[model samples]
Target: MPSLTDSHTFSLPSSCSFLISVTDTNPISLAALRSTHFYLLGEGSNSIFVDDFEGVVVQNKIKGLESDDLNDVIMLRVGAGENWHDLITTCLKNHWYGMENLALIPGSVGAAPIQNIGAYGLEVSTFIESVEFIELETGAKHKIKSNECRFGYRDSIFKNDLAGKVLITHVNFVLPKSNYMETSYGELANLNAPTPEKIFNTVIGIRRKKLPDPRQWGNAGSFFKNPIIDKSLLTQIQHEYPDIPFFCISKTLVKVPAAWLIDKLGFKGKVLGGVQCHPHQPLVLVNIGSATGKDVLEFARLIMSRVKEKFNIELEPEVRLIGRNGLIEL
Candidate 1:
């Protein structure tokens, strides 16, 4: 039984009876988990375990990469357990374009689809061909096409109907040979004709400045989803605070930065016990040294309540909270 104290980014106190790593060619590990209540853990980048898990915790370590050239596009079938950033780096090394804007994101490939990871005007779903998984109950293998994944802003079927019901084994991606870089988000917009490497480096630099290194500071990247609001509501808010920053998602929808909302409430660097709303980025909550899961959750609630009181909009967490009972939604 391996200890999982350091397994999650939040460093929340937790324990499990068994910790197993499943690989690409092996279906037996997943089969053994059929009769047990289990939770699948990836790189622990987005997990905030509130309490000790009772049964089993499985980490996907499947590794392999298969590629095929198809005219203007190249397809890759990557093992679910592979590091997400490493995959992006490999693509860049091989001259494969796409995924440049998603650099520096933490977590394994298997966890990418669960959250439909996106950044800099590009989303993982844009290049995803399909995802392969094995049913938890029967160990039956299946491949779901990208169109059927029900991808939305930081959400997917894996987070809903299929949550904890299957183990992702592989993810297929289709990348183009030519440059199709995205540099329209925030600071990247200032770049002049960015290449894959340029876009990758730029995104990495921006993220490093905004987020804390998990190994040292302890954080799970962005804590809240950017709130999408109706255009009318956005207009109403903008009328009150003309300087409120927003992104036009559509004619009827707009995205308001949750960080801005938190910052508005004077939460930047606010501390509750051992947790602090990172001084530089209010969007990230970090453990200063002795924070417990309860402390983090409580601190998050304070931030949420203040945001709701001020903006009348509820902020949702991007990090999955796992307690002894199962997934905890805040």
Candidate 2:
């Protein structure tokens, strides 16, 4: 078995029957995929292997970057395997703009669209022109336009109907020359006369202060998504705790911070076995040392249960958890 302990950001002890790294899409073939169970992996920043996988683990490393500068918009075709933050830095250096607000986000470009990765007030989906992928079963290539992606808050078609069925090879992004700076989220909102460079630096600084370095402390960034609930529920919670922080998504929907709810329950720095809710950010679950898959599941369940009991809201995991066979629900 091939060890997967270092493959994922969570750094859990695990293994797989076979491991394959795909660097070029042309020569690759998945003829045997019909008979064998397989899992696609990128930089593994947003996934955790809880137990030994009973199948093959395909690591996507196809790499390339091409840019076409038009009069009004710059088109970027990025390889799925490219480091996301590095791409952002490259774009900034080239004065491509727009992606500055997403600086310091972990994982590969391929994984970005799947999660509809966003930060501050910008989402990757906003610049996405299209996605190119190869179907795992037939090895056929296909491209889906941005409008067909069904991008939502922390979601996309790749996470739904297409998950595990195709391998994303590249992402096309279109950035308008007249891009405006966004600083509406959290600490970024306080920036005085923000530029793309300023926003980039501030986003990096903010993430570093809030999120633990994955290499030093094993973590999958945010453990749970910020739950978006009905406005009626928000009003009910506000009655008990007046300062309950929330973002109005619409007239009927509200987005509540998961960290606040967990912190209110005193889960920050809370440890069970070897798994601990991050002290600085309660929404992140970290592997203190020698943490097992079961330990992570147990710790996450505890947080979810507490939040549900108090807030009457269900917390869904932001990170993907793999069991012995494949993906498992909390």
**Highest TM-score, which number?**
2
Tens-place lDDT per residue, model 2, 152-242, is: 9999999999999889999999999999788888888899988999999999989999999989999999999999999999999989988
Q: Judged by lDDT, which candidate is best?
A: 2
Q: After superposition, how far is residue 140 of candidate 2 from its true place, in Å?
A: 1.1
Cα misplacement distance, residue 198 of candidate 2 (Å): 0.4
The runs of at least 3 residues in candidate 2 whose Cα sits more than 4 Å from the true structure, single-residue gaps closed, are: none
For candidate 1, lDDT tens digit of each residue in 3-107?
A: 667998878667888887776645676677878888899999999877788878988888899999899999999999999999999998988889989988999
lDDT of candidate 2 at residue 5, scale 0 to 100:
90
TM-score of each: 0.97, 0.98
lDDT of 1: 0.88
TM-score of 2: 0.98
